[model samples]
Target: MYRSAIFLKISLFFILLILPGTVACYAQSYKIDSLSLLLKSHPKQDDKRAELLLLLATEGMKFDPKQGLPHADEVLSFQNAIKNKNYVASAHRTKAGIFLYLSRFPESLESYNRAITVDKILKNEVGIGAALGNIGIVYMTQGKFPEALKYFLQALKKQEELKNELYVGIMLTNAGIVYTEMGDYKEAMSHYQRALSVFKKYKHFVGQANTLGNIGIVHSKMNNLDEAIKYSKLAIQIGDSIGNTRISARENGNLSGYYSKQRQPDQALKYGSIAIQKNEKINNIKSLGFNYQNFSDAYYQKKNYALSKSYALNALKIGQEVNVTDLKRDASLGLSEVYTALNMPDSAFRYYKMYKEYGDSISNDQKKNEITRMGMQYEFDKTEAVYREKQILAEGQLKQQQLQLALNRAELQRGLQQTALQKALLENEKLVSEEKQKQLIISQNNEKLQSNKLNLLSQQQRFDQLEIRQLWLYGILAIVSLLTVLIYLLNLSRIRKLKFASTLQLREAEQNNLKLEHQYQLSESELRAIRSQMNPHFIFNVLNSIESYIMDNDKRTASRLVQKFASLSRLILENSIKSLIPADKEWKALRLYTELEAMRYNNSFTYSFEHAPEISLSTILLPPMLIQPLIENAILHGIIGQAITDAHISVTMVQSEQTLIIKVSDNGIGLNRTSNKTLVNVVKEKSIGLKSIRERIKLLNLQYPGSASFSVDEGPEQRGTIAVISLPVLGVGSGEI
Candidate 1:
């Protein structure tokens, strides 16, 4: 049993060393020239230069480990000159990764400790988590499984605190690797499963591939070859789709071994060759050694002694160069088999002795006892399941708190509304009273002036008639009667003019009040539109769908859905901030929103857009998302509500001289089922999207009076609804600023 344990330990350590790691994923494809240019532009010893240098070093570490060391050294040398501790910490972390890649365990551990100290001083949680994980990797490589688990768990705790799902997944996978090597397959699988959940949640493709590949390895160890092949292929597929060459190579190598175990030598050879080619392309020496060993194993299974011997020698060369203990052990085993098959007993015995020596080094009593102790401790704690229970409880508490906060916000909004209404009422009453007071004063002044004018006219007549007394007495009396008639006519005309002027003033005041009321309505409608854009129901439904995917363990789909939802929300927010946007921008936002809505509801309907060739979408400007509400109503009411099958919504744009016309038509249970009248007629009962559309049109027309118009009516035969919006052509499309 101890001998078997020794062999298993050596083999597991080799597998861990050869497997592609999640940490190296951050070194994804980057242009060295771009980094060089950036560094050149930033001056020597500058913080920005140091930052870019670290990025370049990170990118180079996995592929060219030696090249990255000098870059890391340069960063450290410049750190004292730079003020930012975070940069210095990142530099140390980069150096640690390079040393780990080069198999310098002690050096890597030292650098990681330095990084941790700097990160602690800077309070950099993420950096600290990374350094901890790196240190753990070093310990794991050195066959210190329990010690590695300690570091991994510590890093995981930090990752959880930061809520960085991707890093958390990476740490979980690392812990699982440790457990697997400790002969605790059950605990290993549990951690891998949890890691898969997190990777899927965030759509971390590299992490997903790593976790899947590890699960396959675990299954392979359990002698479940079929299940091992299933997961290995899945890992390969994900890696291929995401263009992760290194991960794909590692999975292919695993598959090759799996097929070889199943005695499918031909299939084994095919995947082994593929792994070799990919590793060559990436210049991955560690993975190359593993691939070569798998190739030797496949050929050995086929009884091809000569070819098997050649491949084993190749693997041994790489193993010797890299100095990985597990690789050399596996290589010796393969060479021994090749020699035995070739009928060379002496050579076979010599290699077998070397393999035994390697196994002996791996199975020391202290290590075996440590593995047993850690496995027992893990089984007892059931840490992951307990953590999940705690998480679920905390999530429930958070939801309750959020609900209370929302209720409080609603109450505050209601209070503000009441205060505004009261203030408006007071302002209206004050204006009305002031107008009445001015009218009363004008009436009193007019009456006094009229009385004075009449008295003055009478006095002038009396003085003039005395001079012409006896000779023109009859003429004077006739003139006084004519003057009296004239005075009465003048008074009547003045009174009529005053009444007409007062009526005009009253009419003006009424028009002003109507304008104010319309303005208020416009504002209310805009607020409603903003609220609808951020409708809680829609958000809740999207979140529910995402939750469903998470429950189903379909992380990729769920992550994609979340991304689309976020993009739609961002567009809505940006549009709300702008009164007008280019037609193309509005179309882009509407299209994204339509697609997201369709996805949320399981693609129950489809949509398309048609723009007139003559219209320049980039130059034409319109109110942002003006037509989205109408489209939403068409889908929600006309299509979804009515259970319309194969429903299609079409948006068409046409430019005619000085006017731009947009039409939204949907083939669903048309206007006859909903309403026979235009959308305006049902405004009182329709959604805020529709009501806001109406109010917006009114406001738009006021701004450019008679320049915008919209009408909603039943389509041909009333089979569906058609909404048409017309706006004055400001100019050719100039694109959005």
Candidate 2:
């Protein structure tokens, strides 16, 4: 039990260590050398020097973390020279990681705490969450399960607050590891299941591999051998696929143990041998010891006393050297069993006594009690979190309802005011009409009185009365026109106000929609980046090919292939991480990819790319890898399997009005075969390229609606698949600055 416990503890510690980590990924040799050269050359210890020192500490640390210590110390030594608080945090984190790798727990914790303090002062919530998680890892390695779980949950809270699903998944996985150590299988499974969903959604390979491996562990602990083997195989599969030797090695070892428990010596020995090889690569001492023990169990089960005794002795020797009590106890007990089988009474008794002595210090019952208590605590914490989330959701809904009610009331009030103003205008028109009629009657009465006067005076009176009547009629007309104009103006203003309000609401809605679309685009862009990356399978195969060539002493071909693979990989990675790259860069990358495929397949086919003379590739910006999948489909599906001599793929890009029309045509077996499947289905089921391209095109069309399209059909003369992509070209600023 002690041996198994130690294996689980140490294995989980290493699992958590595989992360982007405190500073960043370790640096390449050229980058580290350049930074070191700059540091040596630069006289002033200013911002540049601070940056160089930190880079050297972080990037160079992977090569020799101990050697990187002075660089980290120098960065932290003089804050006056390096005013950047970020440098202070980075330096601390680098120092902490280096110490952690070296198993210096106390110094690692101190450095991590310093980083957390700086992050707190800076109010950097993301940094704080990351540091807390790293600290939890350090604690876990120290065998402090309770404290590790506490810190893991704390970091989970912060990551949840930030809505960073990737880190959230990492924290959940760490918590699961703690729960597993606490002997709470139920809680461990719960956390692991949650983390698995997060990792799958984000396509985080490392998280997925770690979670799968740990879940397999939980099953193994529960005595579910079949499930344990199942998940362990899965973890190994993914880990091997991704070239992650650390977790894969452990899974292989675990699988060996499972087979040993099942009494399948052959299966057990197979996995045990594999585990030994992998563990030796990384010099994983604890795993190696356990693997040796498991290997011995296999041979013991087979009744091969000589080999069994030899392996058991090896395990005992390693256990003694490492001073692992549980491993020693298990190895000694196995030796006792083996000796008893061989009729060696004295040796068996001696080993049995040793095992008893080694077992004296561990208390299983107390650990079980602690596990029960922590499981209850974990459940309570989860319930409380759900309650808080529901409460916050309710509050947000209440606020939204209040806002909507306010808007409705304002709209109703405006409607009523407009109705009242309309009524008032109508009443003013009626009053003016009545006043004009009364004035007309009064003017007629005055005209009759002037008829009784003399001829000359009547003539003068007639002239004056006619002029007064004309002026009176003109005044009445003017007043009527003014009233009409005022009513019209008021009505127009009311309409404008309504229109303005409606337009404002519509604009707000559109902006919100655009905001949501932008977020979606960003997420899709990242997914596309991941999808567009060179396949791990392709990379591994090419490397294998290169290795084969080197083994055969074909150095020139091997070198060329190596260069092509590297260049193609760099270009694809550069293009994938961005929404748009230079058209020519993408074209060249695709060409390189085609060449690598050809070289890998023993020059099975050739390819060419051409752009119109009218197009300036440097100025034209287009999304990366639009035509990549098509080319891949053509090469892999259309040509590679077929017996077609002089096989060639031609790609052409020409400016057609606003569109940059590109075509990829390959000469091989035609796409329309007897399968009765559409080209899309062939692409979707056979590979990820076409589906990813479709999604990418859809996302692009959202930003520039209907400007991007992709299609696959037979080429001219119906020879093979002809894939076409239509992209709306733009100026240079369309890509990342």
lDDT of 2 by residue, 241-301 (tens): 8777666777888888888887788998898889899777656565688898887888888
Candidate 2 residue pairs in backbone clash: none
Per-residue accuracy of model 1 over 1-737 as CA lDDT, tens digit each? 00001111111100001113422332344467777777787777876666677767755644556667787788788778877667677667777766665556688889889888987787776777777777888877666766777787788898799897777778878988877887789998998999899878888787787788888888888889899889888988998897777677778788887887777889988988898897787666766777877777777777888887888788788778766667777888888877887889999999999988876766763487466676868876898789889999999999999999999999999999999999999999999999999999999899898999999999999987886686588888899999999999999999999999999999999999998887677667667777765677668878999999899999998999988888888888877766667778788878887887888878999899889888878887877767778877877767775567879999899988888999999987776676333543453254575557877888888767897888889888768889999987764443223
- lDDT (CA) per prediction: 0.75, 0.77
TM-score of each: 0.47, 0.45
lDDT of 2 at 53: 78
RMSD (Å) of each candidate, 1 decimal: 34.4, 25.8
Q: Where in model 2 is the C-alpha error above 4 Å?
A: 1-80, 98-107, 302-328, 339-354, 357-360, 364-737
Model 2 compared with the native: what TM-score?
Answer: 0.45
- How many residue pairs in model 2 have overlapping backbones? 0
What number of clashing residue pairs does each candidate have, in the order they appear? 7, 0
